[model samples]
Target: MALSKVFVSLMLLISLISTVSSTGVIGGKALPPKKPPVAVAPAYAPIYSPAPSPIAVPPTPAASPPVYAPVRRLIAVQGVVYGKPCSDWGHDTLMHASPLPGAEVRLVCHGKPKENPLKIMATTDKNGYFFILATKKVSEYGAQKRCRVFLQSAPTNSKFIHSTHMNGGLSGAYLRYTKPAKPLLFALYTVGPFAYEPLPSVCHQKV
Candidate 1:
C-alpha cells in the first residue's frame, strides 16, 4: 500500500509539470494570450473635378447705308452800265445818260477771315447790260453785304471817262434786288446802273 501511494503522487507531479510547460507559465505566473493579426484599411481613389464650360458670345450687327447732302445751285449777278457823253450832262437825272456799250464790271466779295476775296467780271452788251455767274456757291460767300460791284473799264475810243455815279463807276455798289432768272436754275441778283462822263475839255469844245 505505501509503494502504490508514492507511485500515484509521482505521476500527478509529472502531469502538472507538462501542463505548465504547454501554457508557457514559469515561477507560478500565467503568461498573456496571443494577439490576432491587425487588418489594413483600403486606400481611397483620387477625386477629380470636372472641366468648366465655355462662355457664349453675342453676334455682330449689320452695317448701315451711307447718307449724302443735297447739292446747291449757282447764282447770277446782273446789272446795267450808263455814260454821260458831255460834262454838261446833269447829275440829277439819268435822262441825259446813254447806255455805255462795251463796258466791263467787276464783282468783289469778302468771305471768311484770312481767305482770299472772291472776284468776278462781266461785260456790257449794246444795251449796257451785264451779268456775272458766281464761280462758287452762294452760301460760300454769305450775304450781299459781303459783295460789291464796280465799273472796271469802258471803250477807249469813246469820249466818256469813268464817273462815280450810283456808287458803281468809282466806289462799290451794293445789291439792290433779287429775282428768278429764266430756266429756274439761276438766281439773279441786280446791282446798279454805273456810269461814265466826258472830261471838262470835251464839254468846253462843244461850248
Candidate 2:
C-alpha cells in the first residue's frame, strides 16, 4: 500500500510540469511573448497658409476749353510836304524844295465801286510835317494799298502853286516805313515829302 501511494504522488507531479511547459501558464492565465514595443510614429507641425489679394480700378479724364488771340488794328498815317521852284520841275527836286508849312494834304482810299471813296485831310505843321490819326472809316479800309496822299491845296497867299511834279502836287504818294505810334494801340504809316512849285513868271523874275 505504501508503494502504491508513492507511485500516485509521482504521477500527479509529472502531469503538472507537462501542462505548464506546453501552455506557458502559471495560474491559469496566458503569458504571450512580449511583442517588440509597438513602433510609435512621431508628431509634426501643421502646414502654413496665406491670405487673398484685392482688385484694381481705372481713373477718369478732365475737360478744357479753347483760347483765341486778339487782332492788330490800323491807327495813324504820317508824312512831310514841300514846295519846289519852277526850275526844279521835271527833275529830282528834293534838295531844291522847301517846306510848305501851311499846305493842305488829303488821304484818298478807293473802296468798292459806286461807293463814295474814304477821304481824310490834314495840314502841314511848322516843319512841313503832317500826321493824320486814323478814323473809324480809315481803319475799316484795313490796309494802305488802296490809299494815297495828294496835295489838296497850298497857302493861297504864298508864291507856291499846285503843280503835278514828282506826284507831290497832283498825283498820289504811296505809304511806306510802317512804325508804331503813341498809345500802343495803333500803327503809323509814312508817306512822301509832297511838293508844290512856284509860278513860272516868278522863276523868270528870280533869274
Query: Which candidate has the highest TM-score of all?
Result: 2
List model 1 lDDT by residue over 1-207, tens digit each.
Answer: 999999999999998899887987866788777688888898899888887787777777788877777555566778888887664454644678888888889888887789888888888999999988887535423447888888888777887774656655568887654755445565567887777777777787887
What ranges in model 2 sit over 4 Å off?
Answer: 1-72, 167-169, 181-183
Q: State the lDDT of candidate 2 residue by residue for 104-197, as single tens digits.
A: 8888887788989888899999889999876765652455677788888887798887555464446688776474544456667878867777
In model 2, which range of ten residues has the least summed lDDT? Answer: 176-185
lDDT of 2 at 170: 69
Predictions in order: lDDT: 0.76, 0.75
Backbone clashes in model 2, listed as residue pairs: none
Candidates in order, TM-scores: namely 0.59, 0.60
TM-score of 1: 0.59
